[model samples]
Target: MSAHSPLPSHELAIRVRALQVGFGTRLVLNNLELDVRRGEVLGFVGGSGTGKSVLARTILGLVQKRAGRVEVFGEDLDQLSKEGHRAMERRWGVLFQHGALFSGLTVLQNVQVPMREYLSLSPILMDELARLKIALVGLKPEAADKYPSELSGGMIKRAALARALALDPELVFLDEPTSGLDPISAAEFDELIKTLQQTLGLTVFMVTHDLDSLYSVCDRVAALADGKVIATGTIEQMLAAEHPWLRTYFHGTRASRLTLARAQSTGA
Candidate 1:
């Protein structure tokens, strides 16, 4: 058998070009363009009402784009039929903002839902696969029998993540992964994302308002303002950005106060 060839550096997992979305006459995304490289984390950050979630939904084909092209794994989204769309969706996994688990299904069944719908695996093999995915997300074996309503917020998130990884997708999209959790739980979740990315070589595209999470986990951040990407770079680079919106967003009064206190304490 021949050895597997390395993937090309320029090959993108997801690409959007001049994407436009609108609801009736109200424009959401305005000619937005983005590219998510393989095995990298790209964070989308903006204040409320910036249409970040709309852009994500457009890319996922949950909503129709008014204009522009969304290409996933190099296939034009508009070119796919209903059946073709289902086939393409198997290549991605999504962790919704609230861990949208089926309340009626147990954790194992929740994770196996996709497998049952998409694959022809036997019950034994499906169970084995579901268990492996649950374990991969650090869920206890016993938790597999529990329902979503019985699990804590963190467990629900983990179970949702397990379901997302059920198909071993090449691309994963997370929306507000840390929302509504205590600081400790949120930080733990961020670390979990880092660990999973390293272990599974997954490409993560997350939309969040958590500055701490952006600084801690993101390799690069794309800031959306006025329905377009205003800046995209490392945290340090974003800190140095001269755009008024970026500066105010990243080094605002709150951050400045924190910096001043630390500086006075350390004399730096």
Candidate 2:
């Protein structure tokens, strides 16, 4: 084969190498490796207890890793000084599973939390930005003053998403984004994510078990098992994978409704 043109190094969003994580005697991820490219929505999936969320947490620096390195936007996380770390943190946003919004804070205030922590903007500017984020995620102005308890599952998810996008982040980590929504609501949320990703040129690392979300929005799929990413490619490659877990996952009863048979084209 002729030599392929090289992709620019700046195109890498996240790179994990020789990662190891454990809690006491129980090791979760071992020697795991993965890469997320810029401007793509990469769906991460695995069976329950496979350490998908754990891996995400480790990369975010919320959970300590026993070994290996994580680099984001081409910078080694460990090498960054305190200020550098804070700067790095500003470039990415995260929406945890279960819409982890603060019950005491209203939706608008929640959206402004990151801004308060990372930015030095006037209150008037902050309010304007927060409202924009809420609207961007499909939430109404009325929902802005409601507490978490006042929102339904779907509304909470949208409010949480608005908070995640508050900083105009280049990348976002979504953990089970569609988890508790009704089918229709989930579909709508998936569409919103796709639109934002394209319009904003945001790279998304979505950890989800929702196959429909995977099929509808992902540019590529990565399957995790036994503490590492066992396979990664377009959805068609996932359906053809010989790996036992991936075989059942991609060709299972739940995946039967996808009408697209050809390999799903990834974004350049």
Per-residue alpha-carbon lDDT of model 2 for 1-268, expressed as tens digits? 1011144557889888889999999989988888888999999999999899999999999999999989899999999999999998889989989889999999999999999998899999999999999988888999999999999989999999999998989999999999989999899999999999999999999999998888899998888888888887877678778988887787777576443342343422
Model 2: how far is 102 from its true place, Å? 1.8
- The global C-alpha lDDT for each of the candidates, from Candidate 1 onward, is 0.85, 0.89
Q: Each model's TM-score, in the order given?
A: 0.88, 0.92
Candidate 2 has a TM-score of 0.92
Task: Name the lDDT value of residue 42 in candidate 1.
Answer: 86
| Candidate 2 pairs with clashing backbones | none
| Best by the TM-score measure | 2
TM-score of 1: 0.88
